[model samples]
Target: MTPDHEVLVIGAGFSGIGAALGLRRAGIDDFVILEERDDVGGSWYANTYPGVAVDISAFSYSFAAEPFASWSRVFPPGEELKAYADHCIDAYALRPHLRFNSRVKRASYSESAHVWTVVLGDGTALTARFVICATGWLTKPKTPAIAGLDTFKGDLVHTAQWDRSLDLDGKRVGVIGTGASAVQIVPEIAERTERLHVYQRTPTWLLPKPDFAVPESVRRLFRRVPATQRTIRLLTDVVTELSFVIAMVHYRRFPFLAKAGEAASKLYLRRQVKGDRTLMRKLTPSYRVGCKRPSLSKGYWRTFTRDHVELVTEPIEEITPSGIRTADGEEQDLDVLILATGFHVLDNLPPFPMRGQGGRDLKEFWKTERFQTYEGTSIKGYPNLWFIVGPYSFTGGSWFGMIDYQVTHALRVIGEARRRRATEAVVRPEKHDRSFRRNLRRMRNTVFLDPSCRGTHSYYLDEHGDAPAVRPASTYEAAWRARHFDLDDYSYER
Candidate 1:
C-alpha cells in the first residue's frame, strides 16, 4: 500500500472497510485502510472463542447498504460474521488499498501544511488529508489482577485471544468472569471438559435469545426478491430501536415491561436450575436488569444443568499454580483456566499519542478534566480528524447503525473541506462542549448511572463514573443529526 493517501482509514474491520467504501462512493478514491492484524475482521477475527455469536439479529447486525440474505442463523456466529466482513472487502475491491500489520503509534497534525502525519509502530510515516479512527471500542482486552496469576502452571487462555488449537477434552477447566464471553464459552466447553467451574463476580440478566435457522424456503424468497430482505431488515431495525425505549431510555417509566423482562429472565434461570435452589439464588441478579448490558442466550442457562458444571460465587482471592483459590480458602484443581474478562473500553484515553493544533497532545488535554469529543466524531483543535465509533456516538442499536451515521458524517465533512479548498476544518470548542453537556443531561436517570448501581461493575461507565458511551436519543433523531452537517459549526482555515 502507498505511504501517502488523500484519506487514511485506521482499521480494516467492518467500520474501517465501511468507511473506505463510504469514501469511495463519495468519489474520493485516494485512500487506504491500515489494519494492525493481518486479517480484516477486527473484533470478529480477534474473538474466536467457542459459542461466540452476535447478540443482535444477523439481519440487523449487517450493514443496511450491504445485504446478505443468506445468513445461516438468527444470530450469526463469529466465523460467519467474519466471512461477511471478508465479503465486503472482496465485493468492494478494498483489498488493494489495505495495509496489513500496520499498527498506528501516533498522529500529529500540522496546521500550516493542513495534513495529518500518521506514524506507524515501526516508525513508518504516512500522510493523509483526512483520518478516520475506526479502531473499534472493544479491541483492547482487560485481564484481572489476581495474586499469583503469573505463577499459574496450568494452561491459560483468554476469550478474546482464544487458542483454538488447545484441546480441552477431559480437562478440568476453570472460567473466570461471568460476563458476555463466559456465558457463551461455558456452554460450549462444559460437555467436553471433565469438570467446569464458573467464577461469578456479578450475575447478568440473560434474556432468552430468539435463535433459529433460516429455512430453505425463506432463503429462496430472500434471493428471488431482494427487497424482501430489506423489508425484513427494516422491520428488525424498528424492533431494535424500540428497545432503546423499553430497555434503555424510558424503562423506569414502563416498569411493567422491565418487570416482564426480569420475570422472564428469572423464569429461565429457575427452569434451568430446577430444584437447585442454591444455584438459582447464585444466578439471580440483585441489581436492576438494565444496569448492566443485558446478555441474550438460550444455551447458557441450560449449560448449567450438566452435573459436571459448577458455578462458584465465592470471591477469588488469588490464582494458585494448581488452580484458583477463593476467599473462603477453598481451592479448586484445574488443568486449564480461561479468562473471559472483557475489554478496556473505558480507558478514557486514545490508545496512541495524538497531537492536534499547536502540538497539543490529546491525552494531556483530557487528563486534567475528562475525555470529550464533538458529536463523538470531531474534537476541538483536531482538524480533519474523525472517529467513526467515538465516545458518546453509540445510539443503542446495532454497531452498523452507529458506524453508518459517523462514517457518512465524516465523509461529508471531508467533502465540504475539499469543496472550499480549506486547509483545516476544526470543530469549535463550544460545539464540542455543548454536545458533551447534552449527553450529560441525558445520562440522568439512566440505568447505568442509577444510584442503585453504585457498586456494580460495568464497562459502560467511564473513569469518572459517568455513563457517556451512548447518546440518549431515538434512531431517527440520531440519523437526522448525522446527515445534517452544519458547516457553520466548524471553523474553516485556509
Candidate 2:
C-alpha cells in the first residue's frame, strides 16, 4: 500500500520548518507539518513571559539563508521571534501544509510496507514514507517535585505556559529555579511586585549580555547591504565558537579556558553587586562555567540587589496554602508562584512514543541501552526516521545552526533515497555504533566530564552519565559533516 504522504514533519517549530524548507528545496512537497500548539513558532510561541528574549545574539539566532535585518534589540524579544516564525511560514507558504492542534500520540513503522504510521492524539493515523521528529527538547516543561505544590491557593504558572491575564502587580510573588527563564523573569517582575522572593536551588553562571536597541541606520545598512548582516553573523558565530564552543569541547586540552570563563563571570558578578561580597557569593555558581547552560543577562544580577527582592537559598520544604515553607521552617506568604524549573531535556527529546522495526520501542531502547544516534539524526533500527534535534544533535552554538545542518543532513539522505527509488533508508548498525562510540570518545575531553559537574544536575547530561544533548564538536564541523558525510553510512533498500 502507498503512504499518505512522501514525508511527515512532526513539528512546526524552527526545526520542523527547516525540514519542510529542505524538502521543498529538494523539489519534494508532499508532506505535512504537525503542531500541537494552536500556532507556529514552537517555544517562542509558547513562552511569552515578561522580558522573554533570545539568550544568544539576534544575528546568530536567525537562519543564514533568510536573514532578518529588522530586529529591535541585540537579543530580540520573544514576540519578535514569534513574528519571525510566522514570517518564515508565510514566506515559504507553509500554512496549508501545517496541521496545528495535531498532537502526535505514537509512531510505528511497518517493516513489510517500509512506511511509518503516525497516530495523532485524536486517534487519526497518517502514513508517510519518512518521518522527521522535530518536537524539540524544550517541548515539555518540568515542575518541581516539591510537596504540597498543588495545595497552594495562589495563582501558579510555569514559565513555559505563562498566562498574560494573570496579574502580579503589587502582589507577593515567589519564583523558583534560577535557570534561564528566571534570569529574565526576576528582573521584569522585581520592580512591579510588592515583594519578590527568588528561590535558587542552584546558581547559574551569569554573563553580561550587551543588549541595546538597534539604531535605524544599522537596520537600514543590514537591509540595504545584506553582506553587512552576514558579516555580523559571521563575527558572532566566530566569537561564540571561541568563547563557548572551544572552552567546553576542548576543556581537557585547554582547562584554563573554562577557568578563565568562570573567573570572568565571577568578576562580572562582583562588579554587578558593587563589592557586596555576600550577594556576590550567593549568586556564584559552584560548577564550572560550561557545565550547566550559563545565562546572559544585563539586569539579572542587579535585580537581586533591589531592596524589595530577596534571594532565598534555603531548600524548599513544602508549599503551604499561604506560600512556601523552607527547610528552616520559615514560610513566606505569596500571592503568586512561578515555576521556572526549566524543561525535561533527555526524557522528552522526542516528546512522545515511537515504535520502530519489529515492535521495538524507542523509549525502552534508550532506557535500556542509553541514548545514542547516528550523527544525532538517525537510529539503526528506526528506518525512514530522522530527528532534527535528536540525542547529541545540538552542537554548542545558536540553535539555528544546529537546525540548518541537521536539515541538510536529513534532506541529503532523503534526496539520495528518492534518486535510488528506495522504499526505506536506515543507518547501518556498524555505522551507527561507530558514530556513537566516536561521540563518547570525543566527549571525554569536554566540560561535562569534569569533576565539578557532579551533582550539578545539568540538563545537558542524561541519566546514563552521558551528555547526549551535545554533539561535542564545533558548529563549523557540524555544518561541514552534515553536508559531506558519507551517504554509504545509510543502507537504502528498494
- Tens-digit lDDT string for candidate 2 (410-470): 9999999999999999999999999999999999999999888989889889878999989
User: How does residue 161 of candidate 2 score in lDDT?
Assistant: 93
Best by lDDT: 2
Task: Provide the TM-score for each candidate, comma-separated.
Answer: 0.96, 0.99
Candidates' lDDT values, in order? 0.84, 0.91
Weakest 10 consecutive residues of candidate 2 by summed lDDT? 344-353
lDDT tens digits by residue: candidate 1, 155-204: 99889999989899999999998899988888888999999999999998
TM-score of 1: 0.96
